[model samples]
Target: MDAFGDGNFEQSEIDPAAEFLAREQNALAGLEDEIPPLPTGPVDDDVTQPKAEDGNDDFSGYTVPKQVTEEPERIRKWREEQKTRLEEKDREEERKKEELREQARKELEDWYKHHEEAISKTKAANRESAKNAEKQFVAETDEIEPGTEWERIAKLCDFNPKTNKSSKDISRMRSIILQLKQNPISTNKKV
Candidate 1:
């Protein structure tokens, strides 16, 4: 008979819940044959060979053996050696850094020495140029005529016309000349 009371029941029309339960029961039956029976008494704590109370066969326990808590001597020695090697490496790096710093200092000093030499040379050349200009001015003044304007200006500057040499106040004389040139007094004016 079919589920709905019609005599047309088909194997493909079976209930899915009943089919699932049948499959589960068959799987459980197969697992029962493959599974070993559990021990009836207290299991031994030994990992290598666990002894059951019934004395069936040798079996190893799942628990791991207790390890020694102390650190080994060889491992400690190796760690100390590694620490020393790292310290030595750090010292070597510091030494190299110091050497680099010293080298940079020397290079800077050399550059400064060259820079100072260049400045000194420029200063010496400028002094030489100034001296040459002064000598040229002296030569021109020495050839001045007795009654000329240049001779008059030289007398006003405290220069010895016969010796053709200026006094110690040559800077002051130059300043006076510069001022007279900038603002000249009329020669035809009556004082």
Candidate 2:
């Protein structure tokens, strides 16, 4: 416990470092109060003005004379004539393009009408060829051979030949399941 004014501490004491810091802070405040005040000067804008000789008023170069309007009128008339000619040329080009487009459309329609039978004949020929290819493929590979593939599968999976009874061939899914179960994992997995 500590007293506020002219009192003594009974239980707790102020730390020496804390007391020294408090005294140092008070001493710094006293020093600051004793220092002289700083002087102030005027701002820069009050002492400076822009000069005309520095080229700020450069409108004198762009000031148009009385005769300037006359020459521009002549140039404007000339440009108007040129613009008219260009517009006429554009209309002519558009008309020519329209005629050419019509001619191309007529030619395409005539060609389609004239060669319609030929197009149908070619498509039918292609369809017939595809059907023949499919028939040849079916004839060649309709039955599985009894040698290598059948023999290996017979040895591995179902091998009861004396009674003449065995399970059907393994399906695609069954083959994948067997391969996954038999092949070891770890580094044996395909890279």
Candidate 3:
């Protein structure tokens, strides 16, 4: 406590360096007394002894037993059989997956065939209805006189403006007549 306090009061002086040196010397002297003395005779190399490597002497003299290092004949045969069974199982799984994929492909083809047939039937019905409507439109317009409003529209529908010949796009003429019939305009009325 006095080492860290203010220097206003007088305190006894203590030398930490001398005390640390004294402790280290006592520890060295104790270690010297516990150490064993070295032999003064000739060394022999015939006797087998364990050697310490990297300061680790726990497994220096240890040896693996022969029974633990080599497997028995029965266990070896069992391991080979297990490997063969696993290969066969993998081949069977792949075959099952291929069969499932083939079945799914066939089902998809059947669905597409049925759907195409239904679509073709619907398109044929629509074409038949359009042809019947065009015949009915021609029959109604044929009765109008040459100087009438319906007669002028029928004559215009008979020829293409750009080619001055018979029109090929009869659907467009039919749509125009359909629109005129749905909403008739009065020529004598004033806005």
Candidate 4:
């Protein structure tokens, strides 16, 4: 029928340009149909009134209350109360610190007392051990005779064997022999 070879092109009576123009006219007419007119009345004063103390706090009416300040006496009283509260808090902290210091002092005293007792016990034990050692030394030296090692040690320690009797000689000889044993090199050189 035409260059595209479509048979409906010849039979159809639809004009695309005319159809598009008709749809545009219909849409434009719908947009203009029955638009509401703009308001023309005076605004009511009640809607713009400020809030009253009667509890109607809607945003349609907003009001700012006056700024109020306390009296000088009331402010002074409040400051005093705040100071008292702070002082009480400080006193409480100080009391706790004092209690801690007292506890620490008591603990230190206990430790010192225990240490003193331990030192006293140790000194007593050491004295007992020394006495036992001296007795044992005397007992050991009691068996020595004229030409023995104890006699030689006694002579070396500036003690005369002739003048010293058995009871006195034994203790003196034991001390001298102990000294000689402690310093063997010096005693050996002397001998």
Ten-residue region with minimum lDDT total, candidate 1: 59-68
Q: Against the hidden reference, what TM-scores do the models get?
A: 0.36, 0.28, 0.40, 0.36
lDDT of each: 0.72, 0.64, 0.71, 0.70
Candidates 1 and 3 compared by lDDT, better number: 1
Clashing pairs for predicted structure model 2, backbone only: none
lDDT of 3 by residue, 26-66 (tens): 87987876866544344345433344677776644443323
Query: Least accurate stretch of 10 residues (summed lDDT) in model 2?
Result: 60-69
Model 2 quality (TM-score): 0.28
Tell me the spans in candidate 2 whose CA falls farther than 4 Å from its real position.
1-68, 72-76, 121-191
The candidate that achieves the highest lDDT relative to the unseen native structure: 1
| Per-model RMSD to reference | 16.6, 29.9, 15.7, 20.0
lDDT of 2 by residue, 1-191 (tens): 33476466465578888999999998798787776643234324323332359777643323222332345887989999999999999999999999999999999999998799789999999999999978975775665453334333433453333443375454664565456445523443575
Candidate 1 structure quality by residue, lDDT tens digits, 1-191: 55688787557778999999999998788887786765445544642344667886545433334454777999999999999999999999999999999999999999999999999999999999999978987887898653355445644464343454553436666666656655655565677
